[model samples]
Target: MTRRTFLRAACAAAVPASLGLPALAQPAAWPARPVRVIVPFGAGSGNDIVARLMGDHLGRALGQPIVVDNRVGANGSIGADAVARSAPDGYTLFVTTNTTQAANPALMKKLNYDPIKDFAPIGRIANTPAMLVVNPSLPVRNLQELITLAKSRPGKLTYASGSAGTLVPAAMLTHMAGIDMLHVPYKTIPPALNDVVAGQVDMMFTDMATGMPQVKGGKVRAIGVSSLQPVASLPDVPPIAATIKGFELLAWYAMYAPAGTPTPIIERLSRELQAAVNHPGLRERLASLGLQPVSSTPQELADFSRSELARWGQLIRSAGIEPE
Candidate 1:
C-alpha cells in the first residue's frame, strides 16, 4: 500500500483507541441505571407486595436497583398518569392492576391518561383472586346466607371497597342477588380489610393475598371465592358462581411503559418480567400469598386490556354504578 494510504488507516485505528471508544460505536444497552417501578396504591397493598417481590428478582436479573414508588390516588390514575407522561426510555415502569386499565375507564368519566393510547404493555405478572369475607360477628356462614341477610335488611348492611377490584365485585353481587347494601370506599385495601375485621363494616370482596391471613387468623370468615373455580390457595372456599351463576371476577397485575418506547426495550422488559414471575421460587412464594403467577406477551396484554375495559363497563352500567 502507498505510504499516505497506510498512514490514513493507522490514524483511523489510533483515533478510536486513543478516545477509548469501541471499534463499532454502538448505543449503550438499556437499564443503564436504577429503574423505578411505580405502584399506584399504598404500601402493604396486594399490588405493592407483588411489585416488591418481583422487583427484587427483576433487579437482580438486570443488575440494577429497582425502586418501587407508591403513588396512590384517584383510584390509581395519578401514578398511571405519571408513567404515561414520562419519557419512553424504559427507566420508568408501571406495576399496576386491572383497576387502572380496565375498571377505571368505566368507573370514572374523566381520566388523565388513555389506557390504550398512552402506554405500552410489557406483560401480565399474575392473577389475584378476591375472597368474599365478612366480619366474624356478621352471622353469615356462606354466600347464600349473606345474600339473604342483605335482602332482609335492605340498605342496612355496608361493604367496603378499596379499589375497582373490590368495588365492582361488591356491586355485582348486590345487583345479581337483588339486595341493597351501602357502599363504603377506602383509599387502600389494608385499611378496608381492617374495618371489616373490626366489624366496622359488614363485608368486602377482599383480595385473597390480604384477606387469607385474616381468614386463617380467625379474624374474618371467608364465604366464597370470586373466581369461577376454587383457587388452590383457598381450596375449601367454594366458587361464588356455584350459588350466583356467572359470578367471576379477578384482579390482574401487569407491567407497562410510556408509549413510544422502543420495541426492543419493550421486548427485553417483557422477557425479564415474565422470567421473574415464572421463576420457581417466586411462583411458590406468590402461591403461598394467594396470588397465581401468570405472564403474557405484549400483544396479549394489549388485547386483554381492551376486552377487560368493555367487560367492566357493561358490568358497571348493569350494577347501576354512576361514574364519578
Candidate 2:
C-alpha cells in the first residue's frame, strides 16, 4: 500500500479512540438517550408504583433519564403489545405485573402479544399480595360472614374487579366458597375501589398498594388477604385461606424488553436493577408500596415467568372463570 493511503487508514482508526467514540466496528453504548418505561396499568396502581421507583433507580444507575409512559386499557394488553412491538433497543423497557405477562393469557380470549415469545425478561421485582375489601356499610365483618350473606342473597351482591390481580382472587373465593355475586368489571382498580367505597359495589379484591391506604383511612373494611400468610401491614386481617382451605395467590412485578434485545444489555440491566432495589432505604420504600422486594437473573425471571403463566392458567380455570 502507498504511504498516504496507509497513513490515512491508520489516522482514521486512531481518531475514534482519541475522540472517545466507538469505532466503525463497535456499536454505540446502549441508551445514549433517555429511556422510556411503559407501565401497562394506570397511574396509582401497584405496577405504576414499582415502575416509577425502579425507573428512578435505573435512570440514575445508567446516567439517563427514565420516562414513564402509561398505556392503559384492555387489561394492560395495549401497553404490553406496545412494548412487544417496540424496537429491541435498550431504551424501551416494560415494568409490569402478572396481569399482562402471566394472567392475561388465561383471562382474555385473544391477545395481540405473546407473553413468552414477544419479550425478553430483565428481572423479577417483587411479590405482591391482594386484599379483599368491603364497604363499611356491608355489615359483613369477615370472610365467612360475607360468604354467608352472598349465599343468602345470591346474585344481589356485586363485586368490582379491574385487573387479574383482583379478578382471579375474587373468582376463586366465590367458586371455592359456593357463593354467587354479580360481576362488575372496570378498566382499573382505582375506579373499582372508588365504587366499593361509594357503596356502588359490595366488595372487591385490590392490591395492598392501592387498598392499604383506604383500609387505614377507614374508607373500606378489610376482610381477608389473598395469601395464606398475613401481610405485615394488616397483621390482624385473616388470610382467605383461614376461611377457605388451600387458597393462595400473589401478583408479581418484573421488567422486560422486547424480544431480541442483546444479551449484554439484558445482563447489565439485571445487575443494575438488583443493585438499585437493594440500595439503602429503597427496600423500605418498596415495602411501603406492599412490595416484597426480590431479585433474579434474566434466565431466572424467564423460568419463573413461564412457571407463573401455567400456575395462573390453572388458577383461572379452577376458579371457573371464563376468558373474556
Candidate 3:
C-alpha cells in the first residue's frame, strides 16, 4: 500500500470508536474550558518558546485560553509523567520534543509513562537542526579543529548536555571520532548553554533557537550544524556531516494528549495545530528562530514517533551510552 494509505488504515485502527469512554462521557461539547499545555522543559528553552507560540494561536482558534506550564527535569520526564496521568478529556495537552517521547525510552532504564501507549498523538509542530557550538576560549574554529583538539586532549575536554537532543549528538561525536570527553548533564538547555558561554564547559550541540543568540552575541562560536546539509539560517556554517560522514540529527516538536482522548477531540486539535503552525505570522516568527515550521496528521506523528524511537535507540547503543 502507498504510505498515505497505510497511515489512514493505521489511524483508523489506532483510534477507538469511543476512545474507551462511555458514549455519554465523551465531552460532546469538547474543550469547555481553558486548555493547559505542559512543556517538559525550562521556561527559556526551545520547547517552552515553541509551546507558547503555538499555544497563543491555538487558544485564539479554539476560543479558549491556552495555559503553558513549564515542568522541567529528568530530560522532560517530570512534565511528561504529569501529562500521562492527567485526565484524557482533551484539557491537558503535551507540547514536547523527541527527547521525551523517543530518546528517553532508550536512554532511561525505566519511565513512568509509556511513550506509545500512554499518550495520543496530536500532531507535529516544527523541526530545527542543532548547532555545534563552543566557548570562544575553546581554541577551535571549526568541526575538524574541534575533532583534532578532542583527540589530542582525550578526557580533558568536556561537553554539556541538557536533553537527549543535545546528549545524543555529543555522544555520536565521540563514537564517530574515537575520542573521549567528559559528559556534564544539566536540567535544561539555557543553563547548559550558559556554562558553555562562561567557559565552564568546552562545547555542546544545541538547537539553533537557543544557541544562535549566543553565537550572534559572540558568547559562543558555532562550528557546524547537525544536519547532512547546511541550514539556511546559518548559511556560512558547514554541516557536521562534512567532517563526520553520515552524522545528522534534528530536534523536533510535537503535541500530544493523554491516551484515550476522544478521536474527535484529537482530530480537531490536530487540525487546529496544523493551522496554527501554518499561520503567516507564526511561520515567520519560527523562521527567525531558525525553526522550520511543519505540521502533520495524528497518524503521521504516531508513525514518526515509532521510527524515531528505533533510530535513536540504535544510535545511543552505538555510542556506548548505557541506559540510566
lDDT of 2 by residue, 211-286 (tens): 9889999999998998889887689999999989998999999999999998999999999999977876888887
- TM-score ranking of the models: 2, 1, 3
Q: Give Cα-based local distance difference scores for all models.
A: 0.91, 0.91, 0.91
Better of 2 and 3 by TM-score: 2
Ranked by lDDT, top first: 2, 3, 1
lDDT of 1 by residue, 117-234 (tens): 9999999989987899999999889999998898889899999999999898898898899999999999889999999999999999988778888999999999998888888877
The 10 consecutive residues of candidate 2 with the worst lDDT sum are 19-28
TM-score of each prediction:
0.91, 0.92, 0.90
Error of 2 at 270 (Å): 0.6
TM-score of 2: 0.92
lDDT of 1: 0.91
Can you tell me which runs of candidate 2 are displaced by over 4 Å?
1-25
